[model samples]
Target: MKWSRAVHHVEELARRCDTPSPVPMLPVTGLWVFGDLLGEPRDLDWAHVAVIVDLPVDDVPWLDIPRGGQHWAQAVRLREPLSCLWRSAAGPVWNHRIVRPALVWDSTDGVRESTLSALRDGLGHSVRLDAPTPSALQTQLDAELAVSLRSLRRQHRSYDDQRWRPGKLTPHADSLWRATDGYLDLLDAVNAPQ
Candidate 1:
């Protein structure tokens, strides 16, 4: 269940299932695998596979997806894309999960590289999967993730409570809530360091 193995596992499954990888389409700047694969190698076991897309992910026109390997793709989906503006919501988790392991990235226009660069600046450092993990970096990241999970759990509970209240909800409220629940479960599962 190491990083490479997990990626190979999913990829092998995709191959066996004859699933083609996706191509980032118009309005979708790029795609990159993120998560345990980007964490420390020894701590890379038991990962929750996820990717980031530039555009609003749901609006991404998938030219192709690993259809045969739809289960994981559908389950975790993504944590959503990061924005270049530091003032915007969704700050870094302090690692390569923010931007590396590029899959369909085309920085010819510099958009992809710029956003990632901006993110690194925001975090005050760069975290790269290709490089060796700095001492205790994994521990620091785990603590960061723990804080994120705790905060999300609180928000999710509040969301659930609001769902049952006497009020008219948006047409996609239930579906959006379910997606958030699934994401929370995925985060909860792979929050470990080893």
Candidate 2:
């Protein structure tokens, strides 16, 4: 998957925002979130996330995961409203909302593998992240998650470079490339259109 590029884009944007840094971005190599954090079986969709940011436990938000939506699979609620505009090779994108920090678990060994194995065995998987756990488990989870995000970023960069060639534009290609360029331009032109 072209996950590395997406991870890189998110990391770059996060850096530009000047917010408190969480754990470094890594690829979704082999990790999973286990415990009360995952409310239901359906929440597994978020299991494939390429980036997981580890936030202070105290600072983590206790917001409800929106019902049946894929848009903000990893979003958290915050007390104060905050927004940012980012441009990528794609086009202009806006993030308008408050965000909270939380512990991120890489699904590599935790949820990803166990869940799939359960499915294959004709058993269903269900667990919540909030349940109490030992510090050792938490440490392992965080470490794996960090590694995964980094790997994802590298993979994404490779995919983007391979799929999109620069300086060789047909009319159709020009329009598509323009969208990506426009996104970057908008980010650079924040508070002023270029």
lDDT of each: 0.36, 0.28
TM-score attained by model 1: 0.31
For every model shown, the clashing-pair count is 0, 33
Error of 1 at 178 (Å): 8.3
User: Model 2 — which ten-residue stretch has the worst lDDT?
Assistant: 91-100
Give the Cα error of residue 170 in candidate 1, in Å: 13
| Local distance difference test, candidate 1 | 0.36
lDDT of 1 by residue, 60-151 (tens): 11121221223434332322221110000122223423433323232333224432432223321243434325544455445444544554
The estimated TM-scores of all candidates read 0.31, 0.20
lDDT of 2 by residue, 41-148 (tens): 232222221223232211111111111112322332211112221111121111111111121223333333344333233232342123323444344334333433
Candidate 1 regions off by >4 Å?
Answer: 1-29, 33-50, 53-100, 106-129, 132-136, 166-194
Model 2 TM-score on a 0 to 1 scale: 0.20
lDDT of 1 at 24: 26
